[model samples]
Target: MTCTIFYSTEMPNEQAKVTGGIPTKPMRWAVDYVVKTPDGRTVVQGEKTIQRATFEELRAVMNHTIGEIGDEVGNEATFVSWRATAHGGKKKNRKGGKRK
Candidate 1:
């Protein structure tokens, strides 16, 4: 159970203080990458913290990283809310559903 958390803030004033001194300003969303499967393809977790300026940028990074594993193995990718996982499961992926 390996999980990587990414935080981004869209506010011009608020910045993400991640590892090292490198700070990401204008943060908006955060992505929690859950790599539980050996085959990879974990998640594209996006939330309020992901900044508007960096949303697509972050998404692109996630897509390149683990998207292939899930797309190839499960043939499905989704945008899931961590808040909903506790109850049941509410996930919404891209329209095409898992890139071809």
Candidate 2:
């Protein structure tokens, strides 16, 4: 059996900058979100949140998991489950739990 997984990438707007000592127009974004209130009725709204990741966060998590599984197999074998979101980023051994 195979399972389908969906991942979302969130990025912040390009921060405004003063170029050549000139100011530019501000950028705006529209979003939707949900909220809960005292009664069954809930307040749902969408707002912006500061972006906290680039895009490799998922890849790092996957690599870490693979490293852990490799350790369980008791070998220096590289976990084939590794994936990369970037073409040329530094590759580091997955950090896994130590074996006895």
CA lDDT scores, all candidates in order? 0.38, 0.30
Please estimate how well model 2 matches the true structure, expressed as its whole-model Cα lDDT.
0.30
Best-fitting candidate, measured by lDDT? 1
Q: Model 1, residue 7: what's the lDDT?
A: 31
Cα displacement (angstroms), candidate 1, residue 57, comes to: 0.7
Query: For candidate 1, lDDT tens digit of each residue in 29-81?
Result: 44554433334444443333334323346556555645564665574544321
Question: How far in Å is the alpha carbon of 39 misplaced in model 2?
Answer: 62
Off by over 4 Å in 1: 1-30, 34-53, 71-100
| Candidate 2: residue 44 Cα off by (Å) | 42
CA deviation > 4 Å runs, candidate 2: 1-54, 76-79, 82-100
Q: By summed lDDT, which 10 consecutive residues of candidate 1 come out lowest? A: 80-89
Task: Give the per-residue lDDT digits (tens) of candidate 2, residues 40-91.
Answer: 3433323332122233343344445445544654534421321121222333
